[model samples]
Target: MNTTSRPGSPAGLRDANRRRVLDAVRGAGAPTQAEIAGVTGLAPATVSNIVRDLAAAGRVEAGDEVRGGRRVRAVRLVRRAGVVAGIDVGHRHVRVALADVADPAGAVDHAAPPERVEVRADLPDDHGVADGLDTASRLLDEVLARTGARRAALRGAVVGLPAPLDLATGAVGASGVLPGWVGVPVAGRVAEHLGVPSWVDNDATLGTLAEQRWGALRGVDDGLFLKLSDGVGAGLVLGGRLYRGPDGTAGEIGHVAVAPGDRFAAVCRCGHRGCLETLVSTRTVTAMLEPLLGAPLTIADVVARAHDGSSGSAPARRVLADTGHHVGVALAGLCTVLTPRRIVVGGELAQAGPLLLAPLHAALEAAAVPGTVRTAEVVTADLAEHAPVLGALALALERCALAP
Candidate 1:
């Protein structure tokens, strides 16, 4: 005897068909049946049936529309059921975003420009963590209220930190970059403060995700994101996914030894001598400039001075060029092994633009093999400093799916 299933009788087939139709509708706003068929690669009959079932279950809305002189039913996803939050914690600032969970792509725009508040990264006292967390939570609440969303409407939140995280214990790695937060469970604290589930990742990794999703790195499977701020860090995108490695330290390019035996080598926060960060980080450049400038100066001041056309900017430009050379030397090794298709530089130093990137390119060409150096194109990040926070929103929206 032949066992044949009736129409829509096999549960698995129906579920798969439903998912395909749902995904197509979500991807294409208000698509006709023929359009949905083309997008999902399904027959017209299958598309019609799936749309009918989805409409009945209140998962989608179908309306009559005329397309090319013919009548067609347009299908669209129902409005998102809940909201999600994205939190980015930098060395000296915190940024947060509130967005709709159902439409992750649109979450980055909920706050338009996002909200940021500066706090000391050193955290010299015991109360630093609590105070910082409270400030971030308050900013989150302000943005939620501005967006006409209640705190209870939040489904989840994603937090980005400037340091690598131990995947197993949810703690910052032993880099000593974040002295006050080495052992603190950042995700847990954010979750408790906001009364929503929270997740954490390195800020550079999140920046890579944001760029791949919404900025210059779109469609690039092999790409590298370098964030040169108070400290230097990197994020890698390989095979269309973020590579965290076994211990979530795959992108710690800052710690790679570059000027190990230099006479003026400075100790890195990680307690390493002459690491790449020691030579290329904004902090290092600032320290190098303080004596010549006759006073302590911020990284922004240095970049501004370098852009100045006067004689005073000569020292600043020289230092930045030298820093770029060292950074390119470290990146050359990475390019030899990974051979990424693109390199996006963000953070404070990136604002130096050609002043920094030009020297970096020259150094990379001088160091790496010609073939590998030619394959990767280095450019400034399109999303700029907001990349990490936008990436956090994308993470929350993708990971926190609510029931229909």
Candidate 2:
């Protein structure tokens, strides 16, 4: 990589060189001044100047070290110079975390419990959007205060929503399931309330970010992160980047038309029939099993029963296996196109483990292209249900560190 800045005005070139130096330091971990100069391909004097500037900015720290029988300066990222906030707003819950830039792993120091909230009805009479936004703002405030992170201390904030967000406007698009969120500038509203820069993206995208940084897919350049819960979505990390398409709806595999006009077709929130979500979502599977059990059952209850074999009801296992099969079918198509090295399953439904993975692996083997299926490894999300929240913190850290 070319570390030299383009020929430009003095200030612009200087800033570019500074960013390059900071990026090299972050990517290489702790290194001596000579090591940084060698990796960045910059002169030792230039590296020294940049390191001095970064130290003054509180972005980097330096210490004296013995190198070649001489005292040499070593530099590393400052882990606690500032903090960033990550907020995840889902259809049924909200999560927030606070973290710093140098420790991009996640906000292990501070986390707020998942807050349950009601979704606004599609009808005009519903005050769902207003109430939900208010509740989210209040929870954000509490989380930040609890973490001892003040507004000024926040370098930036990142929010992840369950719906498809417009990348250009930060608003929910027409195809989104959250009717109240349509036309709502979520990032702007949250930023205004929190008095910080806020960016919003899909929950799956954030999940992919978190997984890439610290979860199952760490160090893998190309992978697929499937989130199976109330709905199915994917985060495609290709060439070490999150590939959100022009419309910001690239990984919406849930609404894909799978079984058109079938008598068993279930209605989808997107007003479609026989979509993948209809057959595979936790909502659908849990609803089917709840009636059979003659009692209300949550997805957790179903997993617990399947684990203990207490519900020897074949229907419970079948529901989980069937849902896994549907997911594998969808992933087979994805694998053919993307050929990712790994596929990580996350969200509420993934807790079933082999009850889901067994059927999913079998379906993938049966449906995917021969070579691709053999190479792809399907595994459970290491973070489990907390993937998105931790991912949001990672997103915030990246934004803050890369900010101009």
Candidate 3:
């Protein structure tokens, strides 16, 4: 049996064609060999040969029978034949998920742990990056061991980081906020430590991928995914692909200006005043609500109060509504350009559900182009807080699906 050629200039066209076939199967959920050929615009014999090779390599599996009398051998991704690990490194926490390449719905092993360093403004970035990487590697090892997956069977690994990434080198970009990670090649280091192939991208980008694949953005071809957690960011998906843009910084909406002066008096980690993050971040909302509630509050606490409609809920609602307004303002321009079919919001702040969405909907209605707004659906992430980790898993699956 002939194996797919390794990715290289000489074999680039073959690799590209193989990837197209794999993507066709993944996108359509499952397809027959004929269907794969039709969708991918490849020759039937080529598709048959490719599928056979993939099946032998444990990347895909053949299912029984055809819908009609066509003798179709149904083919679907073999999600469990090999394992892949996904790790999410956030500002305040780290999460890990272990999944198989053949069956995405199969039992997934997961772990979540608080950031290794104390949550403080003064903590060095190096400490956070080093500790986070260490914690992620350990968690991945545990999940693999617990699931009884062999290291040799690992297909790939993907990580979601809280900061921007240099896509070319897989290094952390200049986010000023993430201290010790300025020049570190995060993906390379993680792969070295874990002894497996690994890839990394911005957390919001992964969340967007997760949402698009399995959540609110399901069938939409173009959309925006906003994550409102300890921080604020957006993910852009256009033309049915995650758009990282030039330098992998396409969706840094958190730093979009929402205010003009020092009147708000809040400085953002990006060194900007009146950025959207300064107004809508959990920290800012909690601070604003604390005085009104006459008590300390966490983001979860505020969301609970907002949901319960307590007298104290008013302040939290107001903050979230205002944040929604700013988000809508920034998104208006994006909607005009991308014209997405939906907007999926995720993160800790989105836990307030309607409290955050209602205002966001209103603001978007007010800000977006009249007819365009009607074409777009704004909703919360169906996977909620798990979006990033799931996205990482999806990324891993994507890599495995295209493996030669």
Per candidate, the number of residue pairs that clash is 0, 0, 10
The global Cα lDDT (0 to 1) of model 3 is 0.76
lDDT (10s digit) by residue, model 2, range 61-99: 999888689887778988666777677666666666666
- Per-residue error for 354 in candidate 1, Å, reads 1.0
The residue pairs that clash in candidate 1, if any, are none
Whole-model lDDT, candidate 1?
0.77
How does each model score on TM-score?
Answer: 0.82, 0.81, 0.78
lDDT of each: 0.77, 0.76, 0.76
- lDDT, candidate 3, at 213: 74
Where model 2 places Cα greater than 4 Å from the true spot, the runs are: 1-42, 61-80, 102-127, 294-296, 402-404
Using lDDT as the measure, the top candidate is 1
Superposition error at 155 for model 1 (Å):
1.1
Candidate 1 vs candidate 3, TM-score winner: 1
